[model samples]
Target: MLTKDDVRGVSAMIPTPCKEGQGGWQYEDSVDLDETARMTEQLIAAGIGSIAANGTTGECAALTLEEKLAFTRTIIEVARGRVPVFAGITTLGTKETVRQMRKFRELGVEGGFVGLPLWQTPTITNSVKFYADLAEAVPEMALMVYANPLFFKSTFPVEFWEGVGKHCPTVVTCKYVGNLMDPKNMLIDLPASMDAAPHVQFLPIDFAAPMAYDLVGDRLKGMWSTSCAMGPEPVVALQRAIDAGDKARMGEIMHDLHGLPNAIPDFKEFSKYNVQVEKIRCNAAGYIKAGPCRAPYEDLPDDWRALTVASGKAWAELCARKYR
Candidate 1:
């Protein structure tokens, strides 16, 4: 079975640093990675041992195959084994994803990070088979399951994950980026993985992580922490409190954590607001290398950005201070 140390350090989802202009996602000749590298090095300096690129937050689905490879290669070069580099493979089909996994294995990937197989004809049963086929393709490397409900209609139940774990043990850790309420229910469903598979490492990765730390998480590994983006001080403080089992300090940190949701405006205009808030928060916390976002999903309207930044800065500042 994979232990927490094997897969449970903080992992940063790499943001594709976008330049505003004419075309969509066209990487101009050789990929320029200075911005991406800076973001990565910031995380490493902050104390995380590993990082992942091209996932949902990184907009993996939007990249072409060569572009994804170029993106992955940039991560590999900077990571350079300082920490294990995990790359996201977001193909819609098992065969294509399996082929991508094989390539990652050759590139010295520590494990494969696969988001749920959605945007396809899917059944929970078919989801189980999809993972099985991928595991069979790369017998040497382990796998990480990424759960994001935003993209597709398919949400695999805990039983589905248990079934996959039972069938293939190499799928070591599950990055459960689902609803915060999922833990209470999952505990009831998954009793134990059988001899055919290893115990699945359950990660409680609802974006509301520190808030869920005590309330909903008893058996979980911590989240795929976004708190890391705000610099190391607060995240490190929170992680230490969590590790020491210090409930008092944990509570203090989570106070800021609980308020994180307050940064967004309370309105139906959220899908656009979320990406905007996330980017501004990143900037306010001194984590981002660039300017306000580009278009379509571009910058928040002037009025909203001003209000959100004031709100975000306050909330983020509380973390840096309160976590201490």
Candidate 2:
């Protein structure tokens, strides 16, 4: 069984719920006792050992503070100590992030995965201070810095990360999710700074498993999964292969996993309809009872929902059989 410190183990980014017609995913107030319990159960059964709610994949940008509280509470309860829960501090600003980070710590969450504020609220110096100060504020829980290049202007260039790491020694990981395909993209120019980063983790959200395994695998603690979020069986198998030093097995698993990307159409191909497609697929996978999402991302048209669900159902069935 994977424990709290094994943060790199397969974890999920759950979808957020909001009130219908309010342009946000609604919370049914039933997630903790049932919905989350079910989701975590499925994930764990398939070898996943962690859960991260309220991240970008969960629509954290659209959630209210109250919703964040509710979501984290449910996730913690439902996980039932079976797997570590890393609460996402998806606050739009530094003050909110601090407050939420404190809140999750109080609730006994295992660790925190936070991103830099989206806009220009904190000066670069203040941003470093924010993380440094936050580390002091929550002395108990470990922290992981999320690197979402699309959301923040100052995501990278190693020097910045090294500076932030200096302030918060508890920050044990960096979720580097950009185009880290080429070794020089990250390691060559910033190897020294990255090596000296405060955290012990350097995880990437990449599907290019072979490239990552070959180039930067030695430096990373783990890899995040968007594709594997919905398909944990093979993902876990691949992860275990990587850990066991079974290069042949790792390549085989990677080939099977990446093939799905070719099958699932690009989000742009569906335009604004991609989210709807995603929800429908989630429903088909048994994570959600209904195919509902926030405005623009919710209530997908029936046609797209049907097609996506059909595909997802086939995939889920395949995974179930193979995993079982």
Candidate 3:
């Protein structure tokens, strides 16, 4: 099994490329494997530390199991061991999740990016047991806990981390998306979570990377970014700036990033349709061909669509000016 050290640097969460039809809503033959292959090569060439697919950005809930398998296979093959790959295996139940993780492990992925089972709110003990069961079943596969309070029921307090640390050794990292909007909550919660789970490295989202790096220093191994779908150059540069302790450069890059969401008409409302907004920006940026958002989550207002396009283009312009 891998350790926290094995999972480091700018970890990117990429959207799955959907085949074009019906104005970006396709139910059949949804995944565009050739485009996925090209996108994988682009990310690796851009110096991304790792690649993660089939998350919320990747439309995990909409993608069929066969589509996900083919998508993961394309990424693993194209990467060819250049960077570590973590594929999302989150499902509605533990048994199905285990079954999916086993498939990805056999495909030669380094680990699984998973969320807690979503049918009911999990208690602290069951939460610990959920991960413990996964580790016990697939001892060979490392785990990255997807700690998203927005989508899942659990808030994942420090006590939860304590239970995980005590019971689950195979959990090497967490995609720490909880309490991100409230820095006051983060200040108290993040470090406490770290203390409770010493072995698991916590990768905060790109917006919070600088604060997290300052808070924990070298112990903060890497960051998770959905913006990398626009282009990895800026995020990779941000990582480099953090590593060098160059606060000025970090600020410049973050300013550009922070502007992206502001370009949207209403960020809070836009956030509700995260999948569509992300795909629009990615296509607008023209970095990787992130075709379109898939079915059941593809609807977006015309006003939101226009602003998302501008936001993505703004990011592209920033990349060209600063990193390209």
State the weakest 10-residue window (summed lDDT) of model 3: 20-29
Give candidate 2 regions above 4 Å deviation.
1-5, 17-33, 121-126, 180-194, 261-277, 287-291, 299-311
CA error at residue 100 for candidate 1, angstroms: 1.8
TM-score of 2: 0.80
Quote the lDDT for 20 in model 1: 36
Q: Which prediction has the highest lDDT against the true structure?
A: 3
TM-score of model 3 vs. true structure: 0.94
Give the residue spans of candidate 3 off by over 4 A: 22-26, 180-184, 261-271
Tens digits of per-residue lDDT, candidate 2, 66-143, equal 666777777777677877777888666766777887788777787787888776744567667767877787767777
Model 1 alpha-carbon drift over 4 Å, by segment: 1-4, 20-32, 180-198, 206-219, 266-276, 290-296, 299-308, 319-324
Measured by TM-score, the strongest candidate is: 3
- Model 3: per-residue Cα lDDT over 130-190, one tens digit each: 9999999999998999998777788889999999899999999998886645644554578
Best to worst by lDDT, what's the order?
3, 2, 1
